[model samples]
Target: MTCTKIAYVVAGTISIFLGVLAFHVYEVYNQDDPDVFPHNLFFPLWFSMDWPSQRTYPFPDHIQYVDRQYYAEILRNPDYAQKLRDENAQYQILDRLFRLKIIRDKFGIPLTLTLDESDTFSMWVEPKYPTFHGIDVGIGKKDGRLYVLYNWHIHSVNLFEDINGMIADIGSQFDSMVCSDKPTVVDGDLVTIDLLLPSSLNDPNKVAEKCGDREYRMCVQGTYHLHNTSGSPVGVLGYTGVIDFTHLGINRGFRVKSLQLKTTENGKRVLYKLN
Candidate 1:
């Protein structure tokens, strides 16, 4: 072949290779924008083009649109509304479960409401139905209270050293089911409740070792009080649960496990009772 013909062939090959490379780059960046077409073969090329007209603009808050539709359907359903009301009535005893407050972190990001140390409520909200029982506190009232409009809610509490507090949170709802009106039975039979412990507590040499020898597990024991409608304590209830550290260590997160509750004398205790 002549030199001029060979040069033309080489130029054609380089152009095709460069085009393929550009398409790959565009695909990587546009993965989140599925609507962008031709995968926008030369991503940088679109920068020189007119905005919106030449490039497919990312869709407006599709999640918000879907959420609006979701709530609209809920609003239209009488049964769903009744269900929510029923849940509220069932957990009314826990209406004051936690003294919650909202504050902002250093970056001005509105931090979610967290539980304060002391509060009075003797029922537990099921983990699956937290939205039904969460206390909604709006800020910026005319009376000089601050408010924040948040899309999400806090679903879990950090126990820290408050073991009995955590027990009350998990046990009250179950107790309510057993005895809502009558003087609560402190010496009731053991009833199963949901409990989950952190994976960090799965230490065989430390936590698990104290639980059992053949089967390594971590056991938690705590006490909580039950009250009647007038806010007088009936008695102290005891809770004990075991965690399968073997499974927890492998999964590296929380999973629902069974815990049992019974009544105990104020001074006498079982399981991980604090001094």
Candidate 2:
């Protein structure tokens, strides 16, 4: 072939190579794109402590804390970051309710009690004690009597079919509490406790045996809520609660299970398992 013809062939090959390279780059960028929500869709603007300048459109402080923590996790593993973000958005309204103390005072339960982690599972019984990590509390009025609702988020634990058993066990304890009338049961995919108290709430450990074992074991996610008779949400509370089972002779257990709550200074979320 002539020199000019050879040059023409080389140019064609280079053009095709550049086009393929550009397509690959576009694909990679699309895969990692952070705008999961549609542009026109309305997502509430939340303030972040990490981004204080956005104060004009600030997320609730609790939400800020959670967002920072989850986004940090995105840096390490982008696979589940969007899932976390979607869940966080659903939790924002509830977090604000607890943060502003609306639910606490409404039910005459203190905010400290809801966020308390010292009492393990006893918070379900003793109103004065702090709430366990996975439990969220709120009050609703039905038929002119005050009713308390307990929302528990059991996550990452291996309860399997035993989850229903554990919740039923917990429900039974609530049913035994001193009440003027029978406790109303509002069972769901998640656990919801509604008890009408005649006097002060009391502790029941009837299911202590089910708290942990080789067959049934679990921990709580940090965010949960309460709903009213019409199924309207009452409030949301966020806190980390992990139950240690090593003392119970369980070889596989979570030493430190951190959910939506901040788990690291750098903002990365973590779930530490001890086996």
Candidate 3:
């Protein structure tokens, strides 16, 4: 996938990472015994919209028009609103996602939220997609029907060519997806692609190779297209690209030009370029 702002999703355990956040939730939940609280006080796995259940989180301070309808619906629903009560029911959501969808450097994106209780109350939202975990997928509105236009995972690649990226950004990085122009490519001559990566230094466990104790690593994925000319008839020989999963992906420049194919064996002349 092409590394864009769309890929940055908030995927993390809210308890520790977001601990400094609203302490009121903690104070209310732990008024009596800390042992009663779930070790992971987030990811409301028990209740789902599917089984007439509701998962609640903090209401955003701002008056966001984008998700006003969705919030209004939840606030109006008793099942949904009940979850916010202080231990009002047998099960409560430790954490929840009100409106968060982002995609980033293909790494460390919020992926899952699970419930711990045995309540029949199952909750749900909408058309969640695969390969969407690493993206910042959130709720929004479009023509009255609610939609999701969140950003997600970060990826990067550098190449000096003028072809539409096919393999790397094959599915997600099209013109309409990024609000950018589609690139054309010429299919002759050798092209070079370079890459750089970053680490979060959060891998204190030393289990992650790229993390290396970094708080985070910016992984990336991208492609560089190349094309041929009208007079040429030779296919491409071969090429290589640097693979780095640490930094977010980027395309410096994409240019389409006419090029002639080099003779391989039978003096065949092949060229590839934009139409």
Sliding window of 10 residues with minimal summed lDDT for model 2? 122-131
Candidate 1, residues 1-275, lDDT tens digits: the string is 99999899879876875686555554444456333222222111111111112111111222122134434554565464233223322232122121111101111222111122332222111111111112222222223322233232222223221543344446545656763322232345332223223444333235323322211122233334444344544344343333332443322212212222222334543221111
User: Looking at candidate 3, what is the lDDT of residue 140?
Assistant: 31
1 or 2, greater by lDDT: 2
Candidate 3 lDDT, 12-124, residue by residue in tens: 44453346333434444444532332221221212112112211223331112123444465456545423322222111111111111211221123322222242222222
Predicted structure with the largest lDDT when compared to the true one = 2
Error of 3 at 216 (Å): 7.4
TM-score of each: 0.17, 0.16, 0.16
Error of 1 at 179 (Å): 25
In model 1, which runs have C-alpha deviations exceeding 4 angstroms? 1-66, 71-226, 234-264, 269-275
What RMSD value applies to candidate 1?
A: 23.9
- Which pairs of residues collide in model 1? 124-173, 139-146, 139-147, 140-146, 140-147
**Candidate 1 similarity to native, TM-score:** 0.17
Badly placed stretches (over 4 Å) of model 2 are: 1-167, 174-220, 223-275
